[model samples]
Target: MQLGLSNKDQKKVLTAFYSLGEVCGTIWDNIV
Candidate 1:
């Protein structure tokens, strides 16, 4: 499945998750 987000958008969302918690790394897809 393709994420409709641009690379920069993807990075920003992931960065937000990373800022929230360490588990975000493992469950990035499910959380968002």
Candidate 2:
């Protein structure tokens, strides 16, 4: 299934996901 996103859009999505993962990791560290 394709949503027909452009390359720029895909890059933005990836960067957002990376930032989200970093935030989650920091929170996890604080909890542990």
Candidate 3:
């Protein structure tokens, strides 16, 4: 299923995903 988001919305989604990934990575580093 596709939401059919516009380019601007897609960019926002990608940015949020990357931010989440960075936060997880930081936590993992602290644990390891």
- TM-score of model number 2: 0.87
* Model 3 residue 12 distance off true place after TM-score fit, in angstroms: 0.2
How far out, in Å, is residue 24 in model 1?
10
TM-score for candidate 3, residues paired by index: 0.86
Best model number under TM-score: 2
Clash-forming residue pairs, model 1: none
**Model 3 agreement with the true structure over 1-32: per-residue lDDT tens digits:** 35799889988999999999999999999999
Look at candidate 3 and give me any clashing residue pairs: none
Report the lDDT of model 3 for residue 31. Answer: 100
Q: What clash count goes with each model?
A: 0, 0, 0
Which TM-score value belongs to model 1? Answer: 0.56
Candidate 3 wrongly placed segments (more than 4 Å):
none
lDDT of 2 by residue, 1-32 (tens): 45798989988988999999999999999999
Give candidate 3's whole-model lDDT. Answer: 0.94
Each candidate's TM vs. the true structure? 0.56, 0.87, 0.86
Among these predictions, the greatest lDDT belongs to 3
